[model samples]
Target: MNAAEVVKSLLVQRFGIPSAHLNAETPLRSLRLDSLALEELRVLLEEQLDIDLEEVSLTPRNTVGQLVAAVDGVAA
Candidate 1:
């Protein structure tokens, strides 16, 4: 799966998020993921995607599409 698909899968499977609530434009905060959860997500993404997230500025204000793009950019 691509970064976006991995992200969406993680959100739904690990976080118990409904698939219906997820979309490219959805804000991170809308998923109710706390700071720790976000951190965990970062680690999970890094491990799963084999990409460094250190340079990526992820915030609650960032949309899912933005995060996916950041990961894809780094992976490429």
Candidate 2:
């Protein structure tokens, strides 16, 4: 799978998010992902994608595109 797939799966499985509404522009806050969730996601990405979260802050204001971009940036 790709970055989006990884993100979507993590949200759905770990946060009980509905797949139907999960779009590239979906807001993290709308999905109820808190700071802890962001930290967990950061850890997951670090282990799975080898991306660091030192710069990427996954907050409710962050868009899916931003998250993808952050991951892409870190992975690069």
Candidate 3:
């Protein structure tokens, strides 16, 4: 899967969000993800995408596009 698909799948799996609402610009804060969930997402990304995000912190305000960008940036 592509980065966008990876991001969407992660959000859906981690937050139990339906695919219909998993837009590229959706704000993570709207889902009310707790700190633990965020950490879980970080681990998920590392394990699935092989991208280590532990050093680069992300926040709720970060959009799916931004997250994908960060991943692409790190991979590059």
TM-score of each: 0.93, 0.86, 0.83
- Model 1 bad stretches (over 4 Å): none
The weakest ten consecutive residues by lDDT in model 1 span 31-40
User: In angstroms, how far off is 15's CA in candidate 1?
Assistant: 1.0
Off by over 4 Å in 3: none
lDDT tens readout by residue for model 2, 1-76: 6777788788788778889978878888888878888888888877877667787767888977788788888777
Better of 2 and 3 by lDDT: 2
Q: Compose the digit string of candidate 1's lDDT tens values, residues 18-60.
A: 9999898999899988778888999999999888898887888
Candidate 3 C-alpha error for residue 14, in Å = 3.4
Looking at model 2, residue 30 earns an lDDT score of 84
The C-alpha RMSD in Å for every predicted model, in order, reads: 0.9, 1.3, 1.5
lDDT of each: 0.89, 0.80, 0.78
Better of 1 and 2 by lDDT: 1
Native-to-model Cα distance after best TM-score fit, residue 72 in candidate 2, in Å:
1.2
Q: Model 1, residue 25: displacement in angstroms?
A: 1.0
CA shift of 21, model 2, Å = 1.6
Model 2 superposed RMSD (Cα): 1.3
lDDT order of candidates, top first: 1, 2, 3
